[model samples]
Structure formats: C-alpha cells, structure tokens
Target: MTTLRPERYSATAIALHWAIALLLLFQIGLGWALEDLPKGAAQFAGYQFHKSVGITILLLSLVRLAVRLFRPRPEPVKDGRAQMLLASAVHGLLYAVMIGGPITGWIIVSTAKVRLQTMLFGKIPWPDLPVGQGFHEPAEVLHGALGTIGIILIGLHVAGALYHHFKREDVIGRMLPGAMKSHGVIGIAALVAIALGIGALICGRLLSFAPANLVTPPIPLPSASSEGDIAAPMESTAPEEPTAVVSESAVSSATATPWKLEKGGRLAFTAEYNGEAIKGSFSRWDATIVFDPEDLPGSSISVTIDLASVESGDSQRDDMLRSDSFFAVGTHPTAQFVSSSIRAAGEGRYVAKGTLLLHGQRKPLTVRFSLNIDGSRATASGNATLQRLAFGVGEAEWSATDQLRDAVGVDFNLKAVKKAR
Candidate 1:
C-alpha cells in the first residue's frame, strides 16, 4: 500500500498561503503610507495596526510552513530544471521575509527612542523584544530592505502564476480557492487585477482611518511680529479725551513704580521626551509689575498665560498637547500666577513667591529672576521648574513619565519701561 500524490494542496495550506500573500501586499502598501502621515494620535494608531498585521502574517506563515511539512502536498509541475530552481529560490526568500520582517519590526519598537508599548489592535498588549537601544537603527534599515526585496519577489511570484495559467496551463489550478474556471481572457485579467487591487484598497482605507474622537479646539492665531519680537506686544495707549473726578481714596498707599511690558518679551518652556528636549513657547500672555528695589514690601507682580497659544513647531504635537490627554485647553484655557511676597536675593536677583493656578490645580511656586534697570527702561529674565504630573497635566497613559518626563522647565524674558503718573 502506497500513498498517492495529490493534484491540489490541502485546504488548510491553500487558505494560509492566500491569506499570507494578500497580507504581505497590504503590509507593504501600509509601510509606505506611514511615512506620509503626520505625527499624532492617528499616525500612532496606524502604526500599531501595521504591527498587528505583521504579527498575524508571521503566525500564519509559520502555520503554513508546518502544514507543508506534515501534510501531503501536490506534486511539483514537471517543467524545465531552470524554472524549478527559480521557483525554489523565490519561495525560500519569501519565507525568509515573511518571518524576519515582523521580528525586526518588533525589535525596532522594543528599542525605540520613545518606548511606546505595542497594543495589538488597541486591545491585546504585545510584549517587546528583549533588546537594547543600538539595535533600533540597524533593525529599521534591515526591515525596509526586506520589504523592498519582498515586493520584488511577490511581483515575480505573481508573474509566474499568470504565465503558468496561460502559457503552461498546468500550475495555477492547484492554488485556486475553488472550482473557479476562467471564462475567457477577460476573466484571467480580472483575477490578477483583483489580487492587486485588494491590497491597495485596504491600504487606502487604513491611511484614512480617523483618530480618537477627542475634540481639539482651535488655538487663536497670534498677531504678526518681527524677528526681534517672538510675542506681539500687549500694550495699548490711553485715550486723550478721558476726564474723570479725582478719587484719591481708590489709590493704594504704597507708591510702587508701575512697569509696562515692552516688545521682545518671551515665555518659553522645555520638556524632556525620551531624553530629548522638546522646546515650546506661549505666544499670548500678560504681566503686571509694580516694584521698588529699595522697598521689597511694596513690590508685587502677577502673570496670566493663555495655555491654548502654545506652539511647539509641530502641528500634530501642538494639537495633542491641547487635547484632554495633556493640557486640556478647552476646559482650562488660562493659567495665572499672583505673587504673595517678593524679596531681594542678591545685588540684582530677586525671588517672588506666588500661587500658580494651572490645569485647575493651585500650588505654591517660587520664581527667581534677575532685574537690570537702565534709566526708565528695565530688563528681566527668570526661570522655574514645575512638575507636570503634579499639576495634572498628563492624564491616563500619558501620566507615565517614562516617555515624557514629569519635570518641565519654564523660562521667560521681558523688557519693561516705567509708566508716568
């Protein structure tokens, strides 16, 4: 008793083969589309989906290989020796790419600069490869090279199948999903076209997928300024026609000098993202200062910042920062600080203790600043460090400080002129 060779592959093998093939084409298209997308929540989700598909291809390819080994397979087409060798080489390379591509991609995510956890389809958490940082760049290069090779091999495989279905008329029927006979030339062309079109359509749909349903409010556009001034000056002149009855009781007893903020003032911040500095600035803010260097008890200062006016040079990142996960500007559009006390620290340095209201949280803050007065014009610069998490700026998964650090540095520079009585 002997086992007779079959004319068609086992149903299981056929299903896996077609599944992996379709996935490979779709994956390649997706990889290219990822580069075109802006850096934001939408792109992040797209990448996760790409990873999920790659993992799926790897599992299915492994199962397909197992089936080929244990189960009886169709006899190979008795073609020329050269054709047989070509087919064998292509098949071997395809298998290598199918397995290696996803592994390299996993390594990339594991050792990424910004280590984000891979969530499969935003549901199942996939563990990263146990790898180190230096592996990321090489793996990325290798992954891209493999994708290029895979595309070329797939084209060759498709061309071979079409040739056999037409010229040889003996090879393609074994892999056909069902008893689907070609009606004519139109039918054969249609079959090939469908195979090609499926992946493109899938890729297009994935690229256009909408982001999480979080409303990102529009930031008010700041007025234009010259290169010398980053922030537009917030100053207005008094009207000449105004005449009112004198009210000496309304004025304060302390005769502290009022300083008007001049142009070229800047309010900037720096935060660490994966050990890299992300620099940004608030374009809209106002300050009130009444100070006397000799009379610290009579001096005071206050600041109000429009949080929605933050610009980090990245539109997507700016949008994300304005969203609920971070600043949540829609809920708390402004942050204010009112000084409780001011003391002279050194010859030119002063420290102002204040209460800062940010992200709906109020906390004590100490600001150290250096002041220089030249006749009536004055210049001041200061810096402060604040914990973003403490103020409830980062919510949910974003609250974790591994990717984005907790401590953020805020710095400001301003020029002012004394207001006449």
Candidate 2:
C-alpha cells in the first residue's frame, strides 16, 4: 500500500488567506485602541486609520471570495458527512462576517451626521455611502454583534482544523504551503492570536465605560459682576503697553482720537449645541480705541476678554466650557484681539482687519461695524465670526463640529466716551 499526499491550496489562494488573516488581526487591535483614546486629534487620527484598514479588509475579502468562486479548491479530507457539514457552515459564516463587518462600519460613517472626511490611511480618499442619519446607532449595534459572532466562528474554524490534524488527517495540509509540515504549531499560534485579540477588546470596553470627568477637577468661573454697574475708571491715565501694533491709515475726513468704553456696553457670543442656539457674554473686557472717521490711517483698536468672566446663563455648561476641553481657563485665562488695519466699508460702516488670540492660537479676523459719534458720546455696533476649532477652543469630544458648530457669532454693542483734549 502506498501513502497518498494531500493536495495543497493554490499559491494565490494561500497568499491571500494569510494576508487577510494578518490584516484582520491588526484591525481588531486597532479598533480596540481607537475606543480607548481620548476624543481629540489623536483619537480622530486613530479612527481614520481604523477605517482605512477596515476598507482594505473589505476589498481583500471580496477578492478572495471571487477567487474562491472561480478557482478550483483542494478536495476535502475523508471525513464524516456531519463533520463536513459543520465545517462548511463555519467557513461560510466566516466569509459572511469578513464582508459584512466593513459594510456595517461604512454604514455607520455614512449616517453619522458629522461632516468627517474619510482619508484612507491619510492618503487615499474614501467616500461615504448615500445613507443619511438615524442608521448610525443601529448599524453600530449590528456591527458590534457581528464582531462577537466572528470571534466565535473563528474559534470553531480553528478548533476543527486542529481536531482533524491531531487525528492524523490531512485537513490542515490542504491550506498550508508545500514547505510547511507541522499543522499543530500554526494552530497553536492562531489560538494565541485569538486570545490576545479578545483580551484587548475586553480592556478597551472597560476604559470606555470609565467616567470622563473623574480625572480632572471642575473648572471654576469668575464671580459675576454687580448688575447694571459700570467699572470705575482707574485714576492713572498712562497708556498700557500694547501687545501688537495697528497700522495707521492716512488721515482722512475721519478724526483720530482716543475713546473709552463706558457703562451699558455688552460683548456677547452665540454658539449652537444639538441644533439649538445658546448665547453667552463676558462681563469683564476692556477696549482701547484711537479712531477718527476722517483719519482712517491713524486709527487703532485693541480688546482684551476675560475668559473666566464668561456667563452663559447655565452654570454647568459654563463650567464645562472653561474646562480643559474648551477654554482651559487655567492655562489661558484671556482672549485678545488687536486691529492691524481699519478701512471704511460704506457710509458710517467700517471693517477692522485684525488678529484674534484665543486658547493660545492666533488667527486673522475681521469685524464689520457701524460707528456713530455724537460729540463726547460714541456708539459702535459690530459682529465677527470666530472659528472655535481654529483656536483649540473645543477639544476631545467637543471637537466634533456636528455637536457644536465651529463658527461662533460674536456681537458687540459698545458705548464709548471720547477723552477730552
């Protein structure tokens, strides 16, 4: 009697099998890492990488399935019909999950409502599906459930191969390369990989369940100022040192003179949360302006905002806003704006080109306003658009633009008294 050799899988099939297996292992670990990261640029980058790998897995799985369908496979070892049927079911489920997991994740991204671009591995661009919001939660649930099912099916598949190989059968040899002889070694490695993957998933879930506010102390806001009261002027009149310079326009019809902020002035901002607009104001801020409607070239203005003096009506929200996630009051307690140039927009209307420094980031800003001077009393009303993210005003989970619009509308109704010559 002559001993028979087992038929091995085609070279292409074997290559794809191992390639996808390694990628799947990497993806499982990446997903676990993504969930445990804090909600910031790092976490965002992690998501992008995870999405890229998931999509790669999806494409590879499709290719493998196509090859499996058109190409011939090695014959099954001599085994009972019941065992063969069980093996077929397990393999079928594995294939289904390999394809379905990425699709479900894609669906979640498609319906997320957040305007996040999918940059595959930070290089290739990937488009979201046509699905809209409302499917995100459901798709997330299904994807997670399928992940659990995939783990189980993988265990069964590995166990079946080991059972046959240990029983002196040719089951594992069918998929192994011709040079490989020991199926037991490969089976044990696969088992270890699966164990490590499960452990990572468990640890990730525990971290996700931990409270976000536990590590950091609550941020404190400055005490509110007395209502309807104006801050008394300092007895000294020496000019305070300026942070930045403003270019003086050529003297024109407008006069250039100093003006001081008086009682009844307000600087407020509006931000949107969950699609609802919320308004807030700073009770303590100072403005220094040297302006003349005719002398546009010799005009300048600078404003300093006390971040801790912010009042948004709701104390809880205000505290959160001052936390490390938003203003980080302890690190940056003030926001400043200095005009670089002032140009007349229209009749009594003007635009101030300037730089705004907030949360340690400085960016160019423009304020459009109308000015009316009535002798010593002057009134100026203006509005400007501020991008919160540009200045790192919101970090972590608050970084999501969908939850809070990046653009905040800042409006000021300033009352000023001109300094006597």
**Global lDDT scores for all candidate models:** 0.70, 0.67
Give the Cα error of residue 116 in candidate 1, in Å: 0.7
Shift in Å, residue 323, candidate 1: 17
Scored against the true structure, residue 237 in model 2 reaches a CA lDDT of: 24
Predictions: Cα RMSD each = 14.4, 14.8
Candidate 2: tens digits of C-alpha lDDT, residues 1-421: 7435337777888878877766766666567666667543334445666788889989999999998887877777668999999999998988888888899999987776444556676467678799867778988998878766876787798789778867877666666677666666656655665676566555533433122212222122111011111111211223333334433333233457777677778889889989999999876677767777777656767777767567787755765666557876545667876666667777777766556778887677656678787877777776666678877878778888999998788877878877763
C-alpha lDDT of residue 334 in model 2: 73
Question: lDDT score, residue 335, model 1?
Answer: 80
Instruction: Output the worst ten-in-a-row residue range by lDDT, candidate 2.
Output: 222-231
Cand. 2 TM to true fold: 0.49
Off by over 4 Å in 1: 181-206, 209-421
